[model samples]
Target: MDAHFARVLADEQDDAPTPGASAAPPASSSRAAPTAALSQQQLDALVARADAQELDQLDARSLRTLVQALERRVRSNALARAKHADAPERFLESELALHSELARWRHVAAAPAALLPELAALNAAPLLLGLFAHDNADIRLDVLALLAELTDAEDDLADADALAARRVWVRALLEHRLLPLVVTSLEQLDSAPGVEDQDEEAAGVYHALQILENVADLEPPACAQLCATTVVLRQLLRQVAAARRFSANKLYASEVLSILLQSGAAPRAHFMAGTVATGTATAPRDDSDSSKRRKQAGAGDLLDRLLQAIAPYRKRNPASEDEEELVENLVNALCSVLLLPAAQMHFRRLEGLELALRCLKDRAQYVFSGALRMLDLALMGDARNCARLVEVGGLKALFAVFMGKKKAKKPTATATATTTRRAKSEAKAKEEELTMSILSSLCALLSPAAAHDVFDRFHAKFVENDMEKLDRVVDVFVKYLGRVEQRDLAGDDDSDDDDDNDEKDENEDARYLRRLDAGLFTLQRATHVLAHLCASSRKLRAYVLVKLHEHRIDMDVLAQILKEQLAMLRGGDSDSDGDGDGDKDVTDTDGERAKMQAQRTLLVHLLSTLQAPTSDAASSAVEPKQEEAKHET
Candidate 1:
């Protein structure tokens, strides 16, 4: 027999039942007894029997019995190795075998929960963690892989007991302080020279990082612990800072950092302060205290790092889908940091807004959306940022896109008819979204203090460009409202159809409704910008009124929207006062009610501003009377 079988047989013989105590089952028996309550001796004998018969020949029951036996044997062997430190090679072999068996078992079903808690118990955690320092790189990799499996909480087990059992394993991992061990192993692996081949090293690193991610996902406190650790934070920062652009590690590091920052796990102020202190060497003023200087410097450095990470992608789009995702995560991290006042200052100083503007011009929708969002956040309640935006001619650049001068795409002539249509539809949708984003940014720029000057700048630009920008905004508003009206009319009609046709019609109607909803949202944002323009400047208001008078269709569109909104408000108020389905959807209608109120307010503001006489009109009228007096003289 094979040497592996010989050892199994020896162990089985040592613990086998006495011949007089119990009889062995007949070989002809089709169904074997369940092994859920098997003792150690019985399990060992089962393993011996499996070795003799070979795993492939075993029936389902026999295979399950062998798996239970292997779990018990691996547990006992790991414990023995932990108790007797002298036999390192023996312990290594046992661990290797256990990992192999576990991998096999994972292919069949969820891991037996008993396996992890046994390995992670006080006695076994140290032994299992010791594998990180094993002489063999492959062994260390295996240990990392096994731990990753042990800590994973994403397995979709339907059985409540299995899920509870899995949670037990996760708790054991946390209770035994395995997270710190995982971090330590990652640090060592990253610092150590090439252990095996390139693939092996990469695999090891990937598994280790995955373990950290899983821990963070399962336990918030563990994530907090990681964030609080200076060494770990530094290491993660280095990974992000030093990683080759668009590399997997860079993406992973960005994701981990995003989680840390967004979860409030790390003390944002402390981390920001640390970055500033380390990255700069400027001495504080004589009156400034060391703690204050440290904090200011840290906030600056943190902002600088985030911008630097985002800077690379401005000139170059991501090379792969993963890198694209990394760009999003990096942008989110930048946005989170920009929430700090100190960080916002650093952002402006670093010309972060310029980078975002450049990204907004990128072809990728996600990059553009992220950049637009960042710009919106930066400009919110910060007049300085709004000034900077105007200083950089951001207004002109955004207006170019807003006016549809910057075509999103030009389809190739070689495409099929359907493909061309789809491409055009996608391009049109993107154009709409981009226009809305620009309008949103413009709205953010129109704070009470900055509104006057910002409006003046826009008015000058509109006149210089022959009022094309204003015309574009008006046209978009009319077009979207018309589409919304068309959808409402179409929704009021019903046509009967066969089941299949009904389903298809329902799907098409659903898609059309979504488009209609998006168009209405765009209309709302455009109206907001129009309202701001009119409210802030009398000249712009006069121009809008003149344009509306010339385009009766546009005037009617705005009037219809206002009238419908007023009717809806009246209906909702009456419903609230009455008992007619008043309580049925009170919670659901609150948001719709608020939105209608805002739209009504903007419409009212636009109308009032347009009706008020401008200084230009008054001056022109006075000049004509002066001419009449001169003629009389």
Candidate 2:
């Protein structure tokens, strides 16, 4: 055939297919053949029309016809170009334009399920693969998004689902000669220039990270290979480290680090450590959302593994504040896991309180709270292992929360008064309940020093500023302490009267009653704080009056304290404030003010204990105390 005739037939063949429809046969029954050859001038004309530089210049019908014709030409040319050992530069450019146009036209066309796979087959060539990492952020983004979407779908195991697509993508990334290109794309996007395009760069990094995150499930060997490469991974690590300082970038870096750790790529643990370091910073960059997302994603699991791997560092003195922060973050993360129902059970059986004790000593606020919470869980839930925790100073640290000088190295200076008060109050509540619970659990197991320490801590709070709080604290201690003393006193009573059975029973019973009376006195002291509470402020008096009316203190003590108050009030002495001399201290002024503050502080504590739902014995015993106080009043 002559070149002109062949060219005409090729044009007609290209015009046969329509967008979103299968190709229709032309008037002639034969399939139109390819152009034998084309002159440079003719090829250039076809190329210009294919470029469609000016859409308005063409008629609507002609534009439609041209698109159909170019679509066919693109498919044919792409195949030919794939096989051509030395495709011309112009042809290669035309191939890229056609591929980009095909991508755009996909939505317009009724894209068969097979279209992407077919395109991928063509594009996976060495020549086309380079375009995947092109400089145009939009092009790179679309390609990646398309690939990710195609891979993310669910179909049959052998189908074109996310798993299948991921496999193909990983295979190409690992076995293809395009590894350098992939690495360069990652780095380029990480340090990409221009603010106008930063979002795109971040997106590209995110896509790569998503793929990396699943590398273990999809391609463990490839993930290991990626980590094995010091040069490539080091840059990725550095990017992650830098990202932790920027709210906008930290998530992407954290995602990548999480993947590395999840896959057990030990080499990449340095990056995870770096992230932990950033998370624990005393003044970490205010990337709260990003940092939180990082933690939410997989940081907990990564942290657990990282800690287990380098436990030797637990005792190593940190090199700097940053290093300490990193250690603190790691401990926080591990303790969080330990508090999980499963981890709590696992560690309790494994005697994990030893490690937890170390965490309590860290002095970081978050770490301390986490350790304390886990210790409580262990003591409350694992009776067999409770002794182990008691042996380690868990009880002491908890008591310290209620009694010790607040950590001198406060985390921040600009805290609000309400926030500081509420925090201390919460710590106080936890400390009290934990102290009582621990003591009860270790009635005989406790060493003398530990028992004394518990008493000392309880005493300290009593003597400190807030006596009303001190009183309730002492009540909790007394409740448990009384039980211990009664048991001991009864034992002594039994030993004293050996053969006198009836007499011994009576004596022991009376001794038990005496111990119960002592127990009631502790409750009385605590209830007595309520009288001081009423005397200090009218608001406190009103609230305490309300609480007194609600749960009347034991009738005997109430009558006694009330009789004391009635005598003092009837005397009309100027000693109402309870601070003595009726010469009110400026810090302790105003009847209603003192009452309001005292009422708030008292109610604050009363409400917490009520909510806590302590041992049934403690709750049931409080009623008699309330009734006694009621009668005295």
Which candidate leads the pack in lDDT?
1
Q: For residues 134-252, write the lDDT of model 2, one tens digit per residue.
A: 43344455455444443332342465463564466446545554345445667767665652245656667766555455444566545545655533445444453422343333444
**What ranges in model 1 sit over 4 Å off?**
1-140, 153-168, 193-197, 215-237, 240-246, 255-300, 335-343, 360-370, 407-424, 427-431, 443-455, 487-517, 546-633
Best by TM-score: 1
In Å, residue 622's CA in model 2 sits off its true spot by 24
Residue 463 lDDT, candidate 2, scale 0-100: 32
Question: Where does candidate 1 have its weakest 10-residue lDDT segment?
Answer: 624-633
RMSD of each: 12.5, 23.2
